[model samples]
Target chain A: MTVLDEIETCIPALRRYAHALLRDREGAEDLVQDCLERAVARRTLWRGDGPVRAWLFRILLNRFRDVRRSAEGRAQLVPLDATVEPARSGGQEAHLDLREVHAAMGRLPFDQRAALLLVALEGMSLAEAARVLDIPEGTLTSRLARARETLRRMTGRAPAQDLVERK
Target chain B: MSDNLPIDDEALIRLRHGEPADREKLADLLAADPSLRERLAEWDRQDAALATLYNPLADEPVPARHQDLLAAAARAPGWRFRWPERIAAAMAFLAIGTVAGWFAALHQMPGPAEADLATEAMRAYATYSVEVLHPVEVPASAASHLESWLSKRVGRPITPPDLSGNGFRLLGGRVLPDSQGTAALMLYENDLGQRLALYVAPAPAGVETAFRFAQSGAAQGFWWVDNRLGCALVGDLPHDALRKLSLSAYDQIDQT
Candidate 1:
């Protein structure tokens, strides 16, 4: 596929990831736009061996970090409310009720959130996510575990204990 | 089963993925402790929920802001030259030599080499003007970011001249190293889509010139040196128009 086509295909995923990270629709869009422009401008930098999706996500992740860092340094941070999109908007399964899950996600450390998004929402393998995040796979595995455990604990709503009777 | 099963995520993920040994061992452990399977399945539900919440966003149309950015990127490079443009450039070169030679003589400036420096700036303008891709590294929409970026990169403070008053708005800028010092290339375009570039750099201790003009082929350039900064404004516009741009750029970029 052409670079533009590849980029277009990745846009939705990048937007989803960005929105999750920033929790502000406009801010997420702005961040993804910057990532797209930078990727296009630096297309030559990509060796073409890896999946374009992974590369784009990597760029998006790095841009988020840089912008977040500078914005934090400036102390002009706009507190991101997690209700930017109420999960029920899509008629998502009411059983899960994951808005609290998202709230817990927002409270996750950056690395843990990033690692979880790569492995969970994006369905990337541990190795692929480790490469994209520039972290060792062991670190990624640990972060994912921590993120999952924290979400479960904070939500206090996992159905695991009741699953035996339900089944 | 618990005696041999690893509790870490690595083993858990392996079991989920059906990696044989890990899955077999984890399955035996799961049979013994049904809660293990339930907990892993619960984690799956949570991840599934998160995905369902976010997947819908991808279906939304890309915003207008991003579409504009893509269009600008498509229009990024300014350096494609057609046969007609090349022919016109050849004709302009002759005209430039005459204008540049006479302009240099009129100045009767102390440094002969500085006149050549003006020609060098003109060359840089020529090199980048015909570019259809990757003209200036940064796009003009981020003018302040471009300014700070070029400034930090070139190790010189660069205040890109505002030419909107002269019917030109900045397209963007890039940095170059010249014999004198750090040189910056800032590109601008007028309403007619006509492009002009200002090449600015520090002048050597002895190299200095008043406003001078140069052309090679169709490109005409006007340049001057003040204190430490040497400035050149080049374009395919008329000699008078380019000259005015040079002087205007000088005023806007003057550090003092």
Candidate 2:
């Protein structure tokens, strides 16, 4: 398939990752739109040697950083932690509290959250996530481990088996 | 506090995320410490929770604005020349006032506010022209329906211009939100799938202007006001070609 078609297949995953990173629906969509525009505009610069999905992810991460830096410079940055609306009503809410999970995600550093979301939410391989973040695989691993620990501690959740028993 | 363990939390996390690991060591670690399995399962549950929270976003249809950006960019030249070329194009485009004086003596140049008609038209063209599943709210097959619906909504007697002579068949049209009340978008496509859009909206009566050209990247537009209606014809065709098509569309709309 053409590069555009491949990019098309990656949009849903990109949106999911963007939403996970920003924790804001409109911002995530706007970020995704900017990402797609850049991806298409620079379509020629992307060599087909690597997976286009990774390249797209790389573009998105870079764009997010640029936006964050500018927002920080302006002192108008809405803390990612502050912007997460509570989980909407009507979910199963059986075992783990998704709201707690989301809040904990917000509290994590951007790097850790990005690594965790790329691996767990987008299901990218560890190496792929590392490439997207332009970090070493070891760094990616530590970030994921730290993110998981922070999340567990912040959410104050027991082991999975314990949650099941409580349910 | 399993930092000293050869199979530490990082290793387990890596394994959970599908990184290749020393399986014999992991299995032995799991066997020696049953709690390791619990930790792995907890991480999996967190992942499950995340999926529950955000996966629905993936299933949501991508908004039309994004689709328009993709369509416009895809149609743009493969190698973008960046701002310099764009600025030069803008200068060249603005210089058309001299050409305008000769082309239509009676009409005035569109001021910045009035130029929104062209911008809106280009935006609508970028959006609807690339739609694969639903290009238009009403299809050309229902010609009369499209005409009457758009006419009534736009509060003008509107009809989709016949451009078959220009080798473009009427594809269909849709009503779009306009800053000045309602606007109508009629689409036409050639056999090669190249599409064009005509945007029509209400303008003050007793005012008329000749065609004014505007270019944004690959999309070119020629907008004019006549018969109390503001109209813009937008497409990705060559400048002269689109200009010709716009004049033809103008004559057809004028006659109707």
Candidate with maximal DockQ: 2
Q: Report the TM-score of the second chain of model 1 against its true counterpart.
A: 0.55
Fnat computed for model 1:
0.37
How would you class the docking of model 1?
Answer: incorrect
Q: What shift in Å separates residue B255 of candidate 1 from its native position after superposition?
A: 27
Candidate 1 lDDT at A50 equals 79
Worst 10 residues of 2 chain A by lDDT: A83-92
Report the lDDT tens digits of candidate 1 across residue range A1-167.
66656877788889999998778888999899989987775554343557889888888887787676566647564434343332322222334666777787787777778888887888887767877886666777777777777676556543444434434
- Segments in model 2 whose C-alpha atoms lie over 4 Å from true places: A76-94, A158-167, B1-6, B18-33, B77-256
User: RMSD (Cα, Å) of candidate 2?
Assistant: 18.8
Q: Candidate 1: misplaced stretches above 4 Å?
A: A76-94, A157-167, B14-33, B71-256
lDDT of 1 at B217: 83
Candidate DockQ scores, in order: 0.23, 0.26
